[model samples]
Target chain A: MVAVYRISAIAVMVEVAIQSMSVVFGIAGQGKWIQEGGVLDKAVIEAREFVFPEVIGYLIHGLNGTILIPLTALILLVSSFFTKVPGAVKWASLVLLAVAVQITLGMSASGLPVLGALHGLNALLLLGAAFYAARLVRRSRTADQGDRLASRA
Target chain B: MGMGYAEHGGHGGQVAGGRSVTSLVADPRRPADVSVTLAAGKERFRLPSGRAFDGFTLNGGSPGPVIRATLGQLVEVRLVNGSVPDGITLHWHGVDVPNAADGVAGVTQDAVRIGEEHVYRFIADQAGTFWYHSHQMSHEQVRGGLLGALVVTPPEQPAETVDVVALVHLYDGVRTVNGNEGDVRVTVPPGKRARVRIVNTDNGPMSAWVGGASYRLVAVDGTDLNRPDPVRDTGVLVTAGGRADVEVTMPEDGSPVRVHLGGTTAVVLGSKSYDAPVVRPPATTLDLLSYGMRASLGFDPNRPDRRFDYDIGRRPGFLRGRPGLWWTVNGSIFPDVPMFVVNEGDVVRMRISNHSGDVHPMHLHGHHAVVLSRNGIPAAGSPWWVDSLNVADGESYEIAFVADNPGIWMDHCHNLPHAAEGLVAHLMYEGVTTPFMIGGTEGNEPE
Candidate 1:
């Protein structure tokens, strides 16, 4: 159970990293397309037109942010209840909360572009939370092994 | 443009030995019966409902001046681009105008840039509810308010019915009726009937229902239905870029009757100001597939001269060098999409299947098609003619149309964003070609 929880949390961290890279890659490609005299307007963006080769980054980022990350976070939260590691459930809850907020921010960023900054910020926060949650399980296992060794000594 | 369609075989192997789109126009010898000038501009305008929006406008308003003309009249519209930088072209939505007058930027004609003027001359051939919007950068311009209602009455119109144009639009996410955020009241005497023309100028389908009284869907997409029955407690789903005309009679008690648009906005018709009861939206919507009386389709769809598969699917790929999940037509992305080629007057049938996990309001310019079947079930309702048909995810539709209008017509998803996302294709008439090019110095991105 602890392994499942740890793996799920770590998976979220990896997914968040991919999401960040994908979005950055998408924007960078869009910027270059515009620089090369390709028109990038609201219509193009709304139509999700692949005017450039790097537009796949947006598709990847969108799928990871909306589906993969949320699924991984939910699994971590579910497994946290059975992990038996102290504070594992609390850390998992924080990671899930950040993900929920992250999705909301990402959805609203189009209408209110100012929210995009917070969306980026929350992604980093989610990554940190997932990393800490995964580390907690490893530290608990190590402490348990040390306790047994001390008792034997 | 640097990105060319050289790989797509340059006009789908049917480009040469064709007539130019410029020659397929209304009779230039006849003087225009109705003439109007529309100035396109981009400005921050405030609606009467106290809502402010920064968007595109036609002749100083979003839902621009209603261009009304009698049937059989030659309509001439001179479009002048005042200040919009991206350019603009007026598309006569739902009106089967001549191929040259069908204002599709880069398809029918080039986008009129700033300070430039383009004149469209076409006879108001079919008399019904229609509209006009910008085809240049339509995904943004149309949503930003570059559209208006175009109503064409019959040569001898009925004098008894009160006509109300409810040009429904969502400006910056705020739903409005005729540019107002609330109910637009039309003064109809008690017991007098009124026809509410609901123009859904949005991305998705909108549900329209009557609140206080039963209403009959008289016309859809500018084509009159064959004996449509009165609908009570049921909503009519109007596809994006589609129009629905609902006829309602005011209650003799003098209370206003509300025609709800997409559940948020409405058009209230009453003798005086009186609160109309807000009826709860019915759980079930009207099944248009088998709603009204059936009639002859003029042409048999079973024996079509040409059949095309407009299968809409989505996959991760590179389009114009942009990498992302993009909408596809026949499994090929934009510039690589199919150019449906057919001869003029040929009976064309198209099977539009959607498995893209999203709904797409497919709109075909220049011609209106009748729905033959949905998911293999033949249409049992009225002729059910439509210029735009909404195909939900996992739904398959078979539609047929007579290829009478000869030009390069755009058959694309009306969800402008989807069109931009590579969900666009052209219905090219055999031996018809356009000189206009997309993505050039003119910046003609006609979504």
Candidate 2:
């Protein structure tokens, strides 16, 4: 369960960093410099520039909501292992690796939309794997059925 | 015949072709002395011939006639203005004549008045598809049917079976094939080889195709004597001022074939009934002269003596304040004030700077150039060979080729209307035998 949490946190951080970097690079290419323009103006211009290529790249690479959500779920599942909640570790690790591969493919696609879409799909698979791992971890802990009842009381 | 004078709007008129008054006659074989008067106005004239052609004409017909001339032959054309509210002059498209015979209203020659006449005498030097129309306010005159094809056949062409000329005309943004609207149907007998020459005298985009068959693109914009390239699938795209010559062997007997055009899906065929087997020969490798290759037995690309950068730019609202003002080369309209001049054997490398806000297909009248680079970067090996190149806005392309054929060649945007507006210029070679007899009017001596 803890491992799942850690992986999910890492994925979120990576996504945010990539998105921010894309925004910055796009603005520079379009000739919108912060020193030359006001903050609001520059931000708006930069945001507009970042939209098309990035969205197209992400969609084509398949790195969308499906990949991210599944990855988060897997993180939650794996973290539950240490807490004696369920089969978290195994599923979380598998989901984490899948999501990681998806993200890597998306980054490496180099303007190809197909890889971006694949990246997005893998996130969903990661979430499913994480959920399954969590369920398994919880079941394993149930071996102490009597203790569970006492603790519940 | 005595010279009879008529006064109209403070202009003098003299009887020349046996007709005292300018009139639009129906006969194509009228006496050389019979002067026909044509007036350019907002009103329309119905054509006496051509099916479904009750078109608006400045003269008597839309796209009048084919002016025939042999290579190295000199012909005299007398232009008279009878009905125009303003003075006008005609420019012979792609003919390498003297500067004075260029017929530019304000630049080359003065506009012929309502009752006056201007005579142009020029020897047809370069052979290929050329056209003629009123250069003054060409947008309106060309639209009104003052344009026609001028075919100059080379004297050295080997004997061929059938000689056919297809003068393609366009009106109001539509191509009128064989006097009919839309794609034209051309019939070729089975097993027979034929030469197809196309001249685009329209103001819009155009492309040519043969349904279920492929053809070889031979010459472009009248630059012949070069090796040919065979094209498969979706025939050549000919912009407004461009021309293409293709030779194809007819299909087997009893097989139906048709010609297709871009933007429309139906096959265009003639109304004649045919019977025969449709047979196309097996594809074989054609020995074509590559852009950089020089061979004595095949077409050789011309070597350049100089090279320059030509930037195509467009300011918004250039056309009558229209927001979508399109394209320009070197910051000037076609036939700009200072034209490009070159001597024979000079290989010129022209870097095209495209900032026109739209894709412009640029074509040179007398030579095929090599595309050397794109956007300041060298092109990959074996770039697609073409005489006409479609350049996108904000992009830059470089083409280098030799200047072998002499005469004044026009380098302009292939868009017809744009060429009319000023997207044209000349390539001149020194010491060639020119067919133009300039200043040959009434008492002027030929230079």
- Measured with C-alpha atoms, the lDDT of residue B359 in candidate 1 is 78
The interface RMSD value for candidate 1 stands at 11.8
In model 1, the runs with Cα more than 4 Å from the true position are A1-153, B1-16
Go through the candidates in order and give the clash count of each: 17, 61
Listing every candidate in turn, what is its Cα RMSD in Å to the true structure after a full C-alpha superposition?
A: 10.4, 19.0
Candidate 2 per-residue C-alpha lDDT over A22-77 given as tens digits, one digit per residue, 9 for 90 to 100 = 54455554444334322221112212223223334434223433355445645554
Indicate which candidate wins on lDDT: 1
Model 1, residue A115: C-alpha shift (Å): 28
DockQ of each two-chain model: 0.05, 0.01
Interface RMSD of each: 11.8, 19.2
TM-score of each: 0.78, 0.53
For candidate 1, give the lDDT.
0.85
